[model samples]
Target: MPASSSRLSSYRLPAFALALLLLLGVGIASVWGVSSLRTSNEWIGHTYEVINRIEVAERAIRSTEANARAYRLTGHPEFRSQYLIATHQVDTAHEALASAIRDNPAQHARVKRMREAAQAHLVELRRLFDLQELQGAEAARQATNSTLTLRQWNEFDTAASEMRREELRLLDQRKARSDRSATLLSAIVVLGMLLSGGLMISLMVSVTRENKRARRLELEARGAAHEMALSMAQVGELSKQRHELARYSGLLQSCQTLDEIVQLSIDTIRRLVPDASGRFYLIRASQNFHDSVASFGDHLISSPDSLMPADCWALRRGQAHMVSGEEARQLSCAHLDTGTPAPGITSLCLPLSAQGTSIGLLHVSAATDAMDHGSAVDELIGQLAEQLGLAIANLQLRETLRTQSLRDPLTGLFNRRYLEESLARELQRCERRNLPLSVLMLDVDHFKRFNDTHGHAAGDALLGQVGRQIQAGVRAEDIACRYGGEEFTVVLPELDAAGALVRAEQIRRAVEIATVQHLGQQLGPVTMSIGISTFPGDGLTPEVLLQLADATLYRAKAEGRNRVLHVSYDD
Candidate 1:
């Protein structure tokens, strides 16, 4: 486990969120700027409108003055009508100026002054006109030249000038202010554009980089997952291997022969390689061939009767052999049938070897479309072969040791030690079952005299013949042991004294009829004097029963050379 190579902490904000915030801020600034620009333009437009209205008012006043001068000069009724129209135009212009400047208190005051001056000038013109009409034109001219008229006309011109000048001054100030606002708005818009463009580019690049990073992270995560799956599979394989080895080791403890060991291996391998059929081929060293001793699961190919050493690739190569389905069809082992292998079939052959000597081969088959064969599976199967080989070898060695310990080499029957041990067990069993158990103590008649007459080989042959006869005469369930030199014992279970005597007579007759041939010389015939002892009637324990039976045999030997004799319990 190395540390991860990701730096997700460095990327706090996602690209979309950053882009959203940037767009929102740009939009808000754009809106605010547009609003500001519109307000500034409105103020600038208001100044122009106010200036135009003031100019109209000034023109109207001057026009009225001209009309009044014309009336005084012409002294006609048409002139009066023109003066009245001019007066109406002047009043309308003043009202328009007033309405236009309503929002500006200072400009409104200037409009108010212009209105008063026009009113006073109109009054003066009306009075002069009245004088001219009532008196004469000369009288009107005199009245117009009056100081009140002159002062009124001067006041009207001054007020109109003042209003125009004030409006012009205010317009200049407002125009300058609006121009600044416009400039600021333009600058804001331009700067905003540049910033937003740069920011947008930056965001785009960041998002691209983020996307790349995210994709890289995803790849790393996927790789890590694949690696983890591989690691888990390897771990599971190792655990199963350990468990399998342990289980086989335990099973080997109870196996007394190579057959049991092979069966155990077959059962285990079937579970380890699921959906795969397998078989164990034990090498018959003397036969020069391999035999299918055990098989488990299913296989694409059926097991054969036997395969020669050259028939297997694993045996020939002295190593594990593997073949994919396609490869197997081209070059499969000779042990398989003489037909084209199935498609999508996988096969593995492991040579079971121990101590550098190949003893057997393990063959397994699985479908190609199934699980992929990892190295771990291969290694485990190899280990299983090794374990199977070792376990079988160990059991075979144990069997050899066991036979040496328990069997008599001369007669190939259970030795005296085994007999005593078995006798004790039978006694215990008889006590539990409340059944009668009997022992037949037998000795060859005149064995010492025969050994003295013949060679040791002849005596050994004679003893072996007697041992075989006893073995053949007893029931399969009976225990026959070579107790000592020329003495044998057979234990019979669930038999009473009468039954024991009948079996003893049978063994006695078997010995009487048996012959021994040594060095091409056929000896006449042999006989055994048998002594019978039953449980509880003779003794309870094995030692006591054997002692009493031996004594009874001494009685039979005394009575005759060859005879089975049993003592009555009620003497």
Candidate 2:
């Protein structure tokens, strides 16, 4: 009995020790795997930042060059300030780029070459400035024709391009490595749980065969616990990512202007899809053109400025076109400027459509030719495009409705409703500023008889011509309205009685000399009667001012039709 007890005691110590050691090993392995994955994710984010900085440097340099040319030509002080600011930004951005790539020897060398070339280009720009100061603008212009400037720019461009390509290559490599690390982490956790369960069960079996049933149940329970913990962790992470996407999508939906929509979409989508470059094209239906309104990232597909409906295969087919892979090899879209696809870049043009109608195309460019898109990224881009299309379409409908309500159908002038609104607002404004506002009430002379002599169509044409003349003569801030049937009104702010009378005379004389032609017949010269009324001096309120002007207009017709009349308060 003593020997058997001793044997059991010896087995139990070694078994417990081994089980405890195995537990520690599993825990340590799991922790190491998770840490590796976190490190990889950080590196991937850094790579994206580096690539973005490189593109920023490219943009800054281009701006500097453009502003430098403008400053040399016009000698405008504002242009000089702009050139200085843009040049300063380029310097700051290059320094940032250099700092970002310090660890990489190859990248550091390329950035050095770019920096040297940029410095030389800036020196040449200053040379032009110095030349302009000593000599004239013509000499500066002659210096602008120097080959040395172009050569320096070309060298800088070449260096910048090489660095961009290298960064893109690094981005891909780092992304793959990050993905592998995440996969490895998950595998390690699962394997550790399995190993611990197996070891615990074997120890239970070796320690006692009589309690095998109970120990087997215990082993299964432990295994179930580990899996449950893992699943809960995964669920929590997925929920967090989903929450982020939902919040950003809500922001996209709330955007007001086309610019706001484009800027927000680019900012959010780039974070979700690293190393992506693309342009957003908005369809201008009035111009019958597809225009590039917004862009982000780098390596964009060069689509034309004025694109036709038939030019985009995506628009023609009513579907998205992937300009990479075998399916894309079938036909290139008309929007693309190339017959053959560029190497190491993936291009996709998805029509931004709402309901059953198409609006515009979203062209996405990937750094790699393979265009390997993760499911999450593809889903995000699709969601952004869908929301943007709906928002912009709604804005278009709203603008159309607003315009129709405010403009007259025949004369293309503001209607009475707009005139009333403008008058009320401008009166309040001018009253506060202590400025004068003038109202001109004018009518075509003998319109009833003229309409009967010509046809109603001719009268309408005559009214349109007068409306256009009034539009051309008034300041942009002034309001010209069709005051119903052959009558017109102009609301001119900051114009007193004297200025108003002068303007009314100009309109009266212009109408007296103008002749209208209908079909094969030429009518006699037309004439207008205009009455001017000034605010505070003639009348204060819009109602009083308009009434006074109308009364004066009647007096003008009574005295002589083709002359201007001023109805003063002192009268």
Candidate 3:
């Protein structure tokens, strides 16, 4: 019996030793799990940062393209400045992305390809600008319309997409590893707690303490895992927002008019912020007031149709103005205030500015009592404002360039170039409709002698008055052009020889009665000779018709100064 007791005691000591070893193993596992979780969190954050850098690089590339195209189209100094800035941004973004992903060979290769594509795109843009300068806008436009630039853009986009996909793949793998680590840590903690329950009375206090510590570590790890998941979700949300912004910007680039841009902006904003109501207000040409170009969503009170620039705080301060909940009732713009208080409403006003000039305003409101107005919303607003501003500015610049190219500056009439183009088009149209077209050639009588006596400035004043008189005399469908020095031409569609004679007589009488004053000195009365030619009767081609009309004008000058002549008058 004593021998049996001795053997049992020996078994008890080894059992206690085995339990202690198990506790130690659990402690080591708890520490390892905490370290693994921290490392996984860090890697997750690194992946997100790398993704952010890639997105920024992509945006920079798009900006470079847009600014380059603008500069090519208008040759505006502001567009050039913007192009330089965008190019710099592209370089900086590429450098940062490359540095961030240097450790990954595959990602590094992708980035290298992306850089090559971007460099090629920039080189092509430079070539286009040089072509514009050396050749003309038409040659540059043709080059831009070619596929070479588009191919480079596509290559860069492909490379960027690959890089992003690879990063996301890595993120998934890392997340899986983190999940396994978390699961293993929880299992180890649970096993330790179960084993500690069987320990001897003398070891109970130490085992209990160790179990408590392990449970605490488990809870902390679970909390961290939750945070990491939330962070991943946030990253995904940010990525989605960026994609939406990119799509919106691409659409804006395709808009050719202010109205199109305004409508598109309203639709995009509504889609992006479903809970928000908004309006877009554009500054008029006179800069005196803001007109509401568009509005979207349901509001408690409709926004003003027009408001003075001073009525809005965003335009006044040239920045964003935001107010939320009860604060909105006190800080809202005068244009928005309906003298009624709005509860739980958030209002944001962002001034749309481009090239250091304020072009318009964007106003939005959302019921934010149930939702927070977080940084994501702010970021979206800022991006929308910037893209909309640039688009509107570029459209306006293009319109201005087109008008200047087609019209004469001094006379406010179509130039000789426009006249030639319109004459041919009108002849074709008249033939198509089985109608007649007329061309009128006009000359200022004794314009050289008048200039010698009254000075060139006075002659300019006389020409200006005659141009206005000619324009006023022509029908809305007729085209009046400053043909050259002391000469004018008008293309009249659907006008017969008789009709053109009457119109010429009217123009002649108007110019004869018109008086000119320059530098407070009244000049002599101005008179012009008119010669008319009709299509199918005079000639079929524009050159032939113009030649016949010019010959008739010489005959008119020989006969009398202020008389109208027709090509058929001699016949």
Error of 2 at 205 (Å): 39
If scored against the real structure, what TM-score would every candidate get?
A: 0.54, 0.50, 0.54
Cα displacement (angstroms), candidate 1, residue 394, comes to 1.8
270 in model 1: Cα distance from truth in Å? 4.2
Give the TM-score ranking, best first.
3, 1, 2
| Top lDDT model | 3
Each candidate's number of clashing pairs is: 1, 1, 0
lDDT of 2 by residue, 1-571 (tens): 3476557657776666776776777678778867876787778788889889988998888889888888777888888889889989989999999999999999899889888998888888888878987996688898785688788878888888888788788778878887887787677667766776776776666557536645777887998899898878756644554565676678866776778878877776666556777788877868476888877776455666557878878777877776653344467777776753566655777788788777887877775422453334455566667777887788778778998999998889999999999998999999999999999999999999989988898898888878887887788899999999988999999999898888877877777777777776777578888888898788889999999899999988998787788896344
1 or 2: which has the higher lDDT?
A: 2
Worst 10 residues of 2 by lDDT: 368-377
Shift of residue 158 alpha carbon in model 2, Å: 99
Residue lDDT tens for model 1, 1-571: 1122234323334544565665676577678767776776777677678778877877887777787778888877787888888889988998888888788787677678778978887877778878877897788887665677677667766766776677678767867776776677677667656765675676566567668878888887997799899889878876876688678778777887766776777677656666778788877868598888877776676657678888888888898877775774456788875663566876777888788877778888777544254546666667777877787777667778988999999888889998988899988998999999999899998999899889778999998998888888888889989999999989998899999988998888888887888899999497788888999778899988898899889888888769888865332
lDDT score of model 1? 0.78
Of the two candidates 2 and 3, the one with more favorable TM-score, higher being better, is 3
C-alpha lDDT score of every prediction, in listed order? 0.78, 0.79, 0.85
